[model samples]
Target chain A: MPALILFWILAIVCIGAALTMVTAANPVRSALSLVVCFLALAVYYVTLSAQFIGAVQVVVYAGAVMVLFLFVIMLLNLGAPVTSSTKGSNQNTAAVALGAILLLVLFISGIFFEIPGKAVSPATAQAQGTVKAVGLTLYNPHLPWLFPFEATSLLLLVAVVGAIVMTRRQV
Target chain B: MLTGLVAYWDNLRDGIYRLFIFPEYWHGIRLPALVPYVALAGIFAFTLGILPMLIWIERVVIGLMQDRTGPNRLGPRGLLQPPADVLKLFFKEDIQPGSIDVRLYYLAPFISMLVALSAGAVIPLQTVTFRNVHGGLYTVPVTPGNVNIGLLFMLAASSLGVYGIILAGWSSNNKYSLLGGLRASAQIISYELAMGLSLLCVVLLAGSVQLDHIVNAQNTLPFGIHWLPSFLKGSIFSWYWLQSLIVPVVIYTVAMIAETNRAPFDLPEAESELVAGFHTEYTSMKFATFFAGEYVNMLMICGLNASVFWGGWLPPFNCFPFTFIPGFVWYILKVMMGIFFYTWLRATLPRLRYDALMNLGWKRMLPLALVWLFLLAGYSLVRTATAPHITPTAVVTVAHVAPGR
Candidate 1:
């Protein structure tokens, strides 16, 4: 019951932070709100017994990624009331339309989508989230999901190359 | 009975749990496992309380290194000095600048201090299966909990530590502060990549991210070099670095030093350039907390290095003529040496130029870490593929014991 209560409290915090992230006038505040949202999601992951996922969520998203975002924002000195990029332009209208479509897709998915996996017992779930368990599952050659995991490395390499190319002139 | 408490308590006495935790006696309640928690609080207290001593040590050691007398006025050999410094910081007014962002400015130090202190949660000071006076069987870990992702959890939190400085610099409403905060954020991010890769090598070797298990893995012949002639196995030289080549260790050492913003890598607070840096506007306890946070962080990194590189609480000898001393004592000695290494570097080396620091972190350390990681991974794969396979022979003994809630 206590766990349930905590989960609900965190759920509220997550939604509130997400809303603030969208609506906050200052870009820095919005970024920070997103960080809070990331933290709230991490807590939910833990409560779901996805402890490794929870830690990674915080480390990768809330810690590393958000810091980069904040660094860029600060470097650009964008803390002033964030202006819409060329109001009433064709791109602005297109952006709004795309956002609306994205929101509609998300809302539909929230109602209809279901993950395809059997619910493991709590002990099994706990074991599954362990480092060794994750390693085994990800590395097992027979597993159908291995290709996607391997592709992630390719994606990261491309991103690194992109960054180097962009920064080449400056350095 | 009191003697028994002393024994159990002594085993629990490491850095964080000693100074602040009073270890309340809840004898009347008959709480089955209250002792360890009380002991844990004591450990937290100790970790915090030791900061003043570390600061004093840094000053005196550095002073001696430079051939000067340091902080001798208050009490015997300046023993009372840290407390006096604390009192003064406590009473000083918290001066908020008129132009600063009020919320983040206050939260900045807090986040910094929090990130610094919470790294203590996963550091295993010593193994604890010690029994209490009431004959309860509870093992309190030096870490607060036995999380599976122990090393990752600390790294995760440490990664978040940059926010404190970034926010502090951005909110301080000064160009210098902003510059300091920017430098710190970039420096932390760059170094963290190398740190993670280096630690990845250790994790791969130890076969676990759990810090205690890392120490346990080290207890064997270092790097699983089981083929070593019998006499050479299980000695101090068998520690991980010497066994698995020193590439990762050297990378980790340099990266950790940079990660903590120590002297040579302290571009964020480059006194000659950035004035006082990120904490330029901070006063009173805010300033004090940042100072304390840095020292505590230094201690934590040293503790972690000891646990990861040296055997944490384990004696250098598994078969000990050195058995008279307890595990925490050995833990302290190793950590002190790590601390001394930091001080020695500070005294010996000058601060890196801004571009030099950047170049070393990105151009040098990062590539070295990546190459070392690939080499270690390749070596592991080849060794496994070529190695002799041994089948396990089951010798199971089953014993029935009382089982109840």
Candidate 2:
């Protein structure tokens, strides 16, 4: 019963922060709201027993990525209160439509999905979320993940080279 | 005084319970849910308790280094100076400049203090081995958190510390504040990679991510070389700093200095350049909290490094009368050594140029850390393959004696 209550509270905070991220006028406020959403999502991950993923989410997204977002927002010389200009009406309409679709998908998935009814045993779930468990799965060739990791590495290398080449000539 | 404090706390707890209508027992059981939080609060109080002492040490050391008497007027050898400083700060007015981001302005220093305090939650001060009144041994680790992911959690929390400085700089909206924030974000993020990699070397040598396992791994000669004569054995040669060529320790030391933004790596808050760096515009208790966070972080990093490099809570050798002393004394001694190292570096070294600092972090420290990690991994792997019997002891029995090492 307590778990149910916590899940609801976290879910509310997550959704509320996500809404605030979209609604906040200042770019920095939006970024701060995004950090709140990320933190709430991390707590949600922990409640579901994905402890390693939860830590990684906070460490990576909220700690590293959002800080960079806030930095960029602060650097942009847009220190004043920001309102969406008339030129971005189309973008605003598209965002609203996409959000509506997302909400619809959530409503449909809530009914169709098993939705935690057949929960894994606590022992197995805890084991599944542990550092060793995640490490083994990620590095295990039998898990079909090694190829994806190699591909990502190769893609990053290419991006680095491309960035250097582009930066060599004045844009 | 200790007993008085205990009695006062018990009275307060009971008074709150009565006021809130909380039952003393629910179905013949006391509340277990509040135990961990209460323990955590104690840990926080302990972490913050040393701030005044730290300030006194830093000021005195720096003064002696520069050939000046440090704050001798406050009390005996300036013992009462920090409290006086604290009082002055509390009485000062908080200044909020116009054209500032008020929300983030208020949020910055609190983030600094919170991250600083929480980062040490996983560090083990002493270990399991106290006998109960029944003469049965009961073992409990003396730390706020002892999770399997202890090291990673510390790394993550330290990484989060960048945000506080960044936000403080940005919200102030001053040119110097912005520069300081940007410098801090850049410097901290650059150095953290090297720090993480250096710590990875310790994890590899111990074959576990847990800090307790790491300490236990250092209790014997390197690779458990039992052939050492009775004259030369345990703790001294067993420490990873000696075993792994001390490269990790060297890299860790430099990275730690940079990570804390102390002098030499303190380009972010350079007084000559940024006018106090990230906290340039902060005043009153907000400023005091930021000041407290820097010293607290220094202690946390020092405690962590002591555990990783030195044998934490372990006497120098088993053959000595050093075993008579409590183990936490050794841990405190090692941490103090680390703090002394910080002061020594600050006194001896001049601040690096911006490019030099970045180059040291990225080109020098990061590559060195990577090389050390690889070397340690290969050495440990070879040792395991050659003689599986000599692997470092990484486990502890729950009912074992009080002194872990």
Candidate 3:
């Protein structure tokens, strides 16, 4: 019962913070809201048994990433009013409509796919999810995923090259 | 009595297991496992509470190194200095600049403290035994979550800490702050790549991502003798710290120093140039958060270096007749040593020029890490190929043959 209440509270905070990030008039307020969202996400990660992930989420996303974003915004001499494009064309509206539809579909599907309950069974859950278990999974039957993972590196490399090229110009 | 004790032990073991692996089960029985939660709360408290003491320790150590008396007023040898400083900060009125973004400024400190505090969760403070909420058995772990993705998780989070400085700098709406933040973000991102690759050598060697497994692998040498194990009759030099890959470890340590923005690399908060850098505008408790966060980063970096290069909590012994100290003690001791090194560097070295910092990171450390990683991978391949092929009978024959022959 307490779990349910705690989860609900975190969920509310997550959604609320996310919304604030979108609508907060000041850029700093938006960043702060984002931190709150990250905190909620970290809590969720904890509940999910991704303890390391949870800690990282709090440390990196809430602590570090948001700080950088805010730092950049502040550096640009930005104020309460960020450079907003009210040049919202029909295309922007259409995109928003599509996003809303997608969200609705996801929300409705969640209601329909009621998962059958499976408890941790105590002993098994305890022994599982260690670094060893994860490594075994990553390098064993799911070893095929390693290829895609390495391939992603190529994508990142290309992106870096592209960024450098774009940023640089002939003197 | 033994049976009762055994049953209690079993229950505790089961509970801890459920908590990490079957988080859903953990969620289900969390109410009943309030004791474990409370214990976890204590760990967080310890992480923060000890940091201030570390700061004082750093000052005193640096003073001793420099042949000066440090913080001698507040309690014996200034032992109570940290508490006094904390009390002072607690009472300082938060000063909000008229021009700055109010929200980001306020949130920056909280972000710093949160990041610093959060890293403690996955760090094994002490080997714990607890009652399983469901199985009525012990669900304890010798090591926490032994997760293969431990290094990756740590890398990702450390990378994120860069943003905190950047945000603090940007939100302050000062040129120095903005510059500091930008430098910090870039520096962190660049060094993190080197740090990850350096540890990748260690990962390649052990062929395992779990921290405990790496330590175990290091406990035995390549030729089969535990070289550094003085207590054991015939163990020889087997620490990963002394491995041929120690080059990469050194590079990794340098990168870590840069990543944490300490000493020579601490340009973001360079007082001479930036007038306190990113958090210049910060005052009172908010400033305290940044202060605490910096120390926490120092701790996390120290712990990471110990875990990856050193045998983390593993003591320097082949086998002790009687084990007295715990794993946590070794881990903490190693971390303190790392911190001591950081302070020593700060006291002795001059801050590098911005261009020099950038150059050293990109030109020096990065290349070394990349080269070392490839070399380690090659070595691993060679080792694997050289190992004699053996069936189950051969394994048994070899084991018997060694003693008999």
Top candidate by TM-score? 2
What's the TM for model 3?
0.75
DockQ-superior candidate, 1 or 2? 1
Error of 2 at A40 (Å): 2.0
For candidate 1, the per-residue lDDT at A58 reads 87
Candidate 3 lDDT (Cα, 0 to 1): 0.69
Q: How close to the true structure is residue B257 of candidate 3, measured as C-alpha lDDT? A: 91
Model 1 spans > 4 angstroms off: A85-119, B1-39, B130-141, B222-234, B382-405
Q: What TM-score does prediction 1 earn?
A: 0.85
- Model 1 agreement with the true structure over A32-92: per-residue lDDT tens digits: 8899999999889888888889999988998789989988887988878857777668996
lDDT of each: 0.79, 0.79, 0.69
> What residue pairs clash in candidate 2, if any at all?
B129-B402
- Sort order, DockQ high to low: 1, 2, 3
lDDT tens readout by residue for model 1, B214-275: 77766665545568643344457777776558888898889989988988888888889999
Provide the DockQ value for model 1: 0.47
lDDT of 2 by residue, A5-113 (tens): 9888988988898888777777777777788889888888877778788888987898777876766666675656666476566887897899899989999988786
lDDT of 3 by residue, B121-200 (tens): 44544344445545454433243334555665666557667656766886788888888887787778667777777887
